[model samples]
Target: MTFKELKHFLGEINVKVDDLYAEKLFNECDTSHSKTLEGSEIEEFYKRLTYRNEIEVIYSKYASSKGKMSVEDLGNFLRMEQREDVGLNEAVALIQKYELDEAAKEKKLMSRDGFLMYLQSSDGLVLNPTHTLVYQDMSQPLNHYFISSSHNTYLMEDQLKGPSSTEAYVRALTKGCRCVELDCWDGPNGDPVIYHGYTLTSKILFKDVIRTVKEYAFKNSEYPVVLSLETHCSMDQQKVMAHHMKTILGSMLLTAPLGGKMPTHFPSPEQLKGKILVKGKKLQSREHSMTSPESLQGEEEESVSEEDEAADLPEEKGMPKKSKLKLARELSDLVVFCKSVHFPGFETARETQAFYEMSSFGESKAFKLAQESANRFVIHNTRQLSRTYPRGTRTDSSNYNPVDLWNAGCQIVALNFQTSDKSMDLNQGKFQQNGFSGYILKPRFMRDGQTQFNPTSIMQGEWLTPKKLHVMIISGQQLPKVNKNKNNSIVDPLVRIEISGVPRDVCSAETEHIEDNGFNPSWNKNFQFDICVPELALVRFVVEDHDTASRNDFVAQYTLPFMSLQNGYRHVPLLTKEGNPIASSSIFVHIMVVDQ
Candidate 1:
């Protein structure tokens, strides 16, 4: 993007920019001396503008011209910015705890390198650079954990009339999505196409989608990719899909059983590293009822859309009549691990169980299970994988709350990634921890075969003691600049801290807002919460500009798992709407945890 174009884009996002800074940034990123950024240079330009450089900014405040800061200087800086009552001695101890002092070759001093190391560690507000990939144990069965997934991974906007592109797959995969859906139908020229059938969603070639997946399947992590295929094609087209996937994916496709015998337990991600498994209706085996005619008829009514039904008939003069397709043996062989099926209530599902048989439930069915058969659902998921998807009525591509299903141990709670609403926000926050690897091991109770824990029926009196959480929102440093326009520029910024957990009513906490100054706006206000259960708690910090006439406009926000929180003085780095870290933007706070 050119400097002028970049300025206009920033303006549309309500960001205030000065010409000098814009020109300088453009020049720095313009490697070819072409005045405009090209290729990866454009992404580099945006990163430089949006990504927060928190460590260098903090170090400059305390470091001298000699590029080193004394221990006393570091202690005083921490006292003023983080813990107001931190004694010099205590600050020194905290510094040592974070290993900032050790980075210095000389004793009693912190060098520039030491400050950078501290910022990259768990002690600083920024995310650890290495935390975005696989950092958790992958030895557990795939059925025993929650996997990050996206629904209709091709749609970029409204389901009925939106563009479908390979970029959608690229975005979700880069964000650590493990399971993605592919709705394939026969397209012109004998190639399969992916789109939301029955809607006006634009289509992309199946081969193009597969190519994109091949390039990015293991970019974020080596965990296997689950391709949830919804097929609407003839047997010939099914052969084409199998051939394209085999040739394109090569050895990456899991086409056979792991060993000679059926797997006693699902394979761990480590065992299927860099492989892609297809999930679709397989040809019927006499033992498995999922492929029965009655089951397929019932699922067709639930999964097929009006547009898809219309396509089946010869509506136009040149249009060919769509015929019912069967799963070819070649295609069925690819679904050896996970065979997608319809959920047949609780009783029938329990009687004939197959480890490879995976069933999906829409929002209504899953809600009924949660409300009426919570324990049954939880126990079933412990031994079998269950996928929960948004109801068909959600044409806008909106999402429902995925927590209830997650609480019941559903492995794949798919959401519409194209929408950045609160539902998607919660999904991002849930997977932000545990290395952001698109998979999280289920909690002990959910995995342990003996425990019959119900998320909605937790007894408050069962536990003897409840924990207390204390937090002080000291100040915000280098916050993002927001304004209406040049004439009505500047904003009155404030911070709101939200506490979320299982029961929605107990989630809200009263917090006083800080006013006026965007840079270094300090509230120093303390807030407390009595947590009956800490295992399901989540904390979200939102920075918004307080306005009298309308709702508070958002400036920046950050959310994460409360269990991953760092105690003592800590910085909370913020993320923009694009999910990139903001440069030099963070909220400083002091945290204290007490168990009653």
Candidate 2:
């Protein structure tokens, strides 16, 4: 019988089907009939049956006792009928006549799978089998794969070859990392240079760095390398450095944001033809706008009058101008050349903080500002926010978890491994548990002492080892497994059995058979034997042959219903001649219950 049919039948009779009682019912029903019924047929019979009087009695009893009947309690009632010599057909008829009001009660105890199906059909919360809410984000399109740092096999320091630092650029390109971040500063000659430090000693000509990256990409099929040129130089020098990057790298280099605009001055489509991506303005909140009362007066006036007077104001005065000098057309044209933008120093925690700080305004103005940006917001140091955010804090009141951050609006949250933040750890755990996809640690974070500029950390530290990071990621999912065992109540959940004793030649063949089938078998007495059992409702075991092959066999199946009061685990004695007790299998059965 279908599980639903069987459940329906039990429901009509004012009886419940629980793990243990369900197993008992299955055994009894199967034994009573010539052939086992399909799970569906069993369920259908109960669903069609009507129970009027029995339901009233059940309801009256529940009312008197101020208690509701559970699936197990219903099973117990059926068990009592069996003990009293009640025929299945007659009992079903009686139940159909009396018990009809318990359908809602049964729903509360559905298995996880069943419950999930109900949720999907009833509430429209489409969830995967793994229990993750499914939705889509328009701004961040899903990419098939991402390039990451090969930290397990390579080190960044090893790439710093010669005064050119070209080797560092080469190493990243050769590894197929489409994106590379380079630290830049002003040199003694007032030129922008590639370096990871704020001082000139670490600087290398910006042109050389771009040339090396371009050469590597050309040799490797024009692979896109998003070179993040972080500048610790004067604004004018930074703009000059951006120009040099465009000259040498052409379409192969990415320019950092310069005064709310992209670096490369692409006046025409020809300038953008083969160049690398250029990042435009950083995603910021409306709060970041530095509008003086003087600038606001004209905008406020424009709302009152729709005339050309509002348009008469100089565009420069109407809009906030770039703080440093760079051709206005160059800034505007570069925007058209850019492929995607990056938000440096934008933190999710900071955004969340901003949300609460603006909560008094009812809606978040910062969030609105981010939404207005056409590009994605790459949040840096998200791990810090995930780790340190108070779990039950008032400002954090939302069903949306950390994995929902990207869907909520932020594109990617970048994590730096060298920085120690509990929020990042927690966020990573949530990501794995929910199966959300996003970026991971790349070369920039893997380089030694790269954490200094990582806003979360004030000091530079040695690069985090790959092994430690992998372990952290793996362990994030380990707690669920551990909890399963720690919460198990069933005692004597496993019993080990050894099979042996056959003619030498026969035994050898049996051993070979086991080995060929990947079953593990071992010797015990003189009679060669294997384990077998009838399928039970409440328990499931992961069995393997103890002989050479380690092939799995059905050692035992419980005949009892599941009792939450009892541990989830259960044990049964091994059988020998004539259903007699013998040794049992040592395998443990991990039961997963689903109700629908």
For candidate 2, which ten residues in a row score worst on lDDT?
469-478
For model 2, state the Cα shift of residue 534 in Å: 34
**Candidate 1 structure quality by residue, lDDT tens digits, 211-296:** 99999999987888999888886677878898899999999998776764456789998788888999877765521332343544
Global lDDT for candidate 2?
A: 0.29
Candidate with best lDDT: 1
Best by TM-score: 1
Task: List model 2 lDDT by residue over 1-596, tens digit each.
Answer: 64455554443322333567655556455543634555664453333332223234433442322354334443344344212233444434333333444453234222222222222231111112232221222121112112221110111232223133566567544533344555555667677766433112244677776677677753442323334333345656656765766677653543332244433222221232234553332212211322222433322111111111112223444464323322222222232222222122344434444211111001132233334421122232222111111111111122122222221222222222112233233233223211232222222322222233221121323322211000000000000011123322112111222211111111111111122111112221122212111010111111222333443333332112111101111122222111222232221111222221
- Give me the runs in candidate 2 sitting further than 4 Å from their true place: 1-176, 196-201, 217-224, 231-239, 251-275, 281-333, 337-412, 415-596
- Clashing residue pairs in candidate 1 are 51-583, 52-582, 52-583, 52-584, 53-583, 53-584, 198-307
Measured against the true structure, the TM-scores of the candidates, in listed sequence, are 0.77, 0.27
Give the worst 10-residue stretch by lDDT in candidate 1. 300-309
Superposed Cα RMSD, model 1: 9.2
